[model samples]
Target: MRKRLFILGLLLIGIFLFIWINNKWIVVSEYTINSSDMPAAFDGVRIVHLSDLQRTSFGKKQLPVLEKVAAAEPDAIFITGDLVDADRFKLEPVLTLLNGLSEISDVYFVTGNQEISKDRAEEVLSALKRTEITILENEKAKWNREGETVYIAGIHDPLMDISTYDPLIDVNFRNQEIEYSKRARDYTRESLEEVPFTDDFTFLLTHRPEMIEEYAETPADLVFAGHAHGGQIRIPGIGGLFAPGQGFFPELTEGVHEFGDIRLVITRGLGNSSFPLRINNRPEVTVVTLEHEEVTGLNK
Candidate 1:
């Protein structure tokens, strides 16, 4: 009887482990939304959005997971925030991986709370200087793909220090730093303000999903974010268990939510945080396809 009980316990444990890994990997949840702003030339363009990858939390298995995503062959790749593991984990290999992804699709990056340069500001600055990836800081990149030109706007995580200057204030004129979110928005807004009003479509890249409420009122057709980590553990019906910002349950925890005239998508990301990992909330990448239309109610 004792032996039988022990064997049953072991079986249960194995089953639980299997379930967890399957949820963590294997299951890649996808989100697809329609943007009336998409140009006719690139109507079905597929974009893969990745977020909240705390490198320290994920194991060796993550690389193969990422490679699988690359195989999907997305036209554009957008990374929202927290790529580095709270400024400690070596981001070199991650950078190298991103560099390789450049061959697959045009990749873009934005900042996150973890990307904040509060601790080693100088170090982060020096490293970003070497990357070929377009780190959108309150700027817009115009792409002429599929015989149509479209605009993609990028905003760094609102909880970080975004400075165009590196080693500029040698006088130690610190303490003038503004709220991270405000800084991110002002700069990103400045970037998109210059885009032609008639551009094919404009999508925003922001790290914190909290900014969606404000950005939705803007001209953006859709805004993407991923800082919540899907509350690390989601509860049924009630949705995300607990989100950091906005208190209680955040509206933009995961999946899709609509703001005034824009759509918002919050990715669960590809790694873990807070509790070091997730439960039912599997890490994922979103492939958003845009379509053109002569329709109204663009939420603009």
Candidate 2:
């Protein structure tokens, strides 16, 4: 009986280990976003969205991750945020991944919670600029193909203020920081105020998905976000169990969510943070192909 019980225990441990290792493996999730606002010249254009990598590396020099991205043939690459792990002192892994990715295509970046947290702000920003990756913070970039243009814009995470230049700040400081979500909206609105509303299809890049409600009201046609980490753990039928900004069973945890004409695509993210592993959730790199819809019937 003792021998049998010991064997069973070992088997159980093996099974758990298998599940944990497999879950940590990276996976690519592809999505096609069709919009009538998309210019005809932009059809079939691929934009790879990577978010919340948090300094995780896949193979030496991030070869595996880069291989997958290069295979997709992305016309542009958008890294939403959290390229570095918050607790990590070494940024080589993050820089290695960035340098590898930049070789593949145009790499755009924005701030995440980790990038701004605990005295890492300047270091993170400086490294990104040094790599020559375009930093889109409350700004827009125009991508022209065949004489048609699309705009890509990005915003700084609200935590950019909370985590910078203050190590002694308390929980109340965080609460005060979150309040800046409103300010983020105002900034975006003001920035785009001069640009005509129908000028082009504006894609907004933000770190936090929880601010989707506010972003929906902006002039942005689409928003890309990643900060939930797929709620840390997702259950089959029940969906994401919990997320930092959205709380338990958060509604905006992952996938594409729409509010009227404004669409928000939230990536499950590329790596982990506080939690060491995810159960049903695997690391993700979202590839979005933009398709143009022809106006017909009353729309014409």
Candidate 3:
């Protein structure tokens, strides 16, 4: 009887391991963000946010990830950054996915910390340009439909070049033990100065979710970010366990986080950077639908 029990335990362990491995594979998460600020014409617009790819590939030529994006039938796809891992720095998977996505729809790309951290930054940038992906490097792009415009802007990660940051870190934020919030906010404001807040729906694509406060300070109606990688591991009732910028028990690891009038959508991200294992945290591709409401409250 004891021998049989031991075999049964091993089988259970094997099954558990298989399920864990499967969860690391790509999973599409859908979200709808309703805002009073959204334009009537832009309502129901679908956006697929992909982040922290970090040299991870799904199936042949990233077909699993691509197939999911294609299935969404997005109006636009926003890639928040970290397309390649800083250490590994693989090109084929990155280029393959980018080329595939560009053909499907309008693809907007942004820089994550890894993009600059990697030695092959210029090479990656050049490939993106060649693919005809709109690379928003501290610049804004306009998408107009039916004479209505949606403004999209992206900022280079502050860590890419620290010399550019404002010397004065907001002590108030630091005192609260919030790392990089002040500096990130300052960097975001300076980077986005030219793109003014207008009546149109404004979207900011940032790689770091830690700068949510700074992003909210701006006139952007919506912000999409990825970098935390779902805190690598999540603890059921406690949410994500840890993240780079937000640190232990990160408050803004994944899902929707609000900052007054503005909303931030953080993707769990597909791929591992530094951490090899994930527990209860699956690779994700988030789809957010723009909802225009006549009377808006903080309900959704």
Candidate 4:
């Protein structure tokens, strides 16, 4: 009996250690995006994609995250929102991270559902405006290199449409949830309509990855997004068990998914929101390298 109890205690300790490591350890996911539409001058440009911070601090002043991003030597950094959690609203951590990131490379941002769910979005935006970071809200920005240009566009999260934002709307009745998603999609379409997309390589930054269809309708060649925290937990072969917008067995939890001519890159994100624990899904910072594929007559 004594030996059995000792073994059980050891097993429990192992379980605890595993959970702690998964939550605290940060992983860097790398991907190479190749496209003939890419400008030759922009070839080999690196982009560090971060999302759904939810006010998580990795080391003092976000050193862990900053160090990882700096190591990537990114030409630009894109954040897809949830920088502050409405439940535990704090702007200092988010600012600290932004300051460090700014020193490394140009930073770009977009709103997430969490930003809209809380009334403090204005505060967040105000703080960001004080920095060099470009806040893209239903707008477009131009990225140039060697006189060649590409467009970067961003849209506000659909939750902004709600006069009284309720984070729990997803957990409500099935019909209501469906209606909310439909409305959100329409809002996304409307927002994109405001941004003009040229034939040049274009990148779209948004919070939710589940809105792939809305984004696909646009002329964006690439989309960087988050909001599904790797579905909170991952099963080896089964993938994410659940996600906020996608629900059980959510499809767009992480990785690059293609929709016709466009590709969507979903970062697992760095922090937790409603769910406090992450199982098997380690927090990650995504590094995407752009490669301008040379088109040949045979391929064409």
Candidate 5:
């Protein structure tokens, strides 16, 4: 009986670990947000979103994966932070892969925590500037799609204040906490950034996903964020169990969540951190289709 019990225990452990290594990706999460005020031509506007490259050498194989996203024929490509890891130094390969993507769609970018690492941020920025990419730091830019212009606002990685370069002495964000609230608001209010929010449909590209509640009340129609890496673990029904910010039993782990007037879409992110391992949650680059959520549909 004891031996049988032992075998059952082993089997359970095996299944438990299998859950950790489950594969949940199905060619990115496609969301269609319906908006009444959105332009008709921009009605089915498609966007491909990528985050947390960490400046790693993804090679030719990874390059093709990106083409898969482009193959979706997205109108725009949006990248949210963590482009490079810094200390190790070398974004050339990542840049090479991105450079080829120019043929895919209009590309826009925002910095991430890893990109701001003092070890190579300045250097990385210099190289990035040389590219045709738009580096949005507390700024905004507009793209004309079929006569109507759409605005995308991007903010620098607020988490870059600490971590990276110096080696992250405190993994615990204490008094050195990053302020995402005020800075995000300041960028919007001043119009010193991307598309102004009065009557147009706007999207905010951010690195950290923890501030959904904070940005929920802002003028943004859709906010895209990635940093949690889908808690790096997920259960069948419980969903992503770990994520940055919001603490312990964190509310936002990954995927989409609605907060009042704003809709927040958080990517599980591509790449691993803190741990060099990943199971079920594979790296992801999303192709999200924004369907105008009729102004009336919002209350639901």
Candidate 6:
């Protein structure tokens, strides 16, 4: 009996350790985006992408995330929303992260459902405006390099449409989601229309990877998104078990997905919401490097 109890204790300890590591461990995902349309001046431009912080802090004042971004030497950093969790909203963690990141490189951001759903959403937005981070709301910003330009456009999360009410418990929640998704797509299309279509590469930053279809309809060369939280729990070869928007066995949980000529990069994100812990899926930070490929002769 004594031996059996001892073994059970060991097993419980092991389980606890596993859960802690999975939730706290941070991993870096690296990718190279090759595009024939990439301007020569922007080639090798490294971008550090972060998302869905959800009020999770790594180390003191987000030292772990900051150190990783600084090490990557990014030309720019893009955060695709959820800096704070609506359920347990706080501003310090979000501000700490944004302040640290701004020191490293120019930071750009777009909102996620969490930001829109929070009661104090306006406070969060106001604080962000005071910082160096540029908040893109249905608009575009230009980055110039050696006389060449790349456009970075961002759209508001679909949740903004229903910010005044609680959509989660509504009798028509599913129908509302469907309708909001379409609205989100239209918002993307309309926002892009305002950009005066150009040949230079364009990057779209959004919070929901599930909206890839809507984003693909635009002329963006690449899209960065979060909010799936790696399905909240990954299953090795099987992928994520469930994501808020994608539901069970979601297809767009993480990694790179392609839609026609456009590519989308989804970050698993650094924090957790709704679900308390992450299983098998560690918090993720993504680094993407742009490679310009020349189209020669007949292709040109």
Over the stretch 25-79, how does candidate 2's per-residue lDDT look in tens digits? 7788888889998899999999898988885667788887888899999999999
User: Which candidate achieves the best lDDT against the true structure?
Assistant: 4
How would you encode candidate 6's per-residue C-alpha lDDT over 103-181 as one tens digit per residue? 9999999988898885666877899999999999878899999999999988877667656655676788878777766
Root mean square deviation (Cα) for candidate 1:
6.0
**Worst 10 contiguous positions by lDDT, candidate 2:** 161-170
lDDT per residue as tens, model 3, 53-131: 8967787888888889999999999999999987888878999999899887899999887887735567778877888
lDDT of 1 by residue, 1-300 (tens): 999999999999998896567346634556666655576777767788888767643345356556756776788888887777753567675676676667677788877767774454346545764776777776678878767787777765544446443234544434333343456666555544544443347778888777655576567777888888777677777777666554566666778887666788888777765566566777776777666655657655
The Cα local distance difference test for each model comes to: 0.68, 0.81, 0.82, 0.90, 0.67, 0.87
> All candidates' TM-scores?
0.79, 0.88, 0.86, 0.94, 0.78, 0.93
Better of 2 and 3 by lDDT: 3
lDDT-wise, the better of 2 and 6 is: 6
Worst 10 residues of 5 by lDDT: 159-168
Residue 138 in candidate 1, Cα distance off native in Å: 0.9
- Roughly what TM-score does model 4 have, to 2 decimal places? 0.94
| Model 4 CA deviation exceeding 4 Å by range | 1-9, 167-172
Q: Candidate 3: worst 10 consecutive residues by lDDT? A: 162-171
Off by over 4 Å in 1: 4-12, 15-23, 56-62, 161-200, 294-300
* Candidates 4 and 6 compared by TM-score, better number: 4
Clashes of 5: 16
lDDT, candidate 1, equals 0.68
- Best TM-score among the predictions, by candidate number: 4
Candidate scoring better on TM-score of 3 and 4: 4
Total clashing residue pairs per candidate? 5, 0, 0, 0, 16, 0
Q: What is the C-alpha RMSD of each candidate to the true structure, in Å?
A: 6.0, 3.1, 4.9, 2.0, 5.4, 1.9
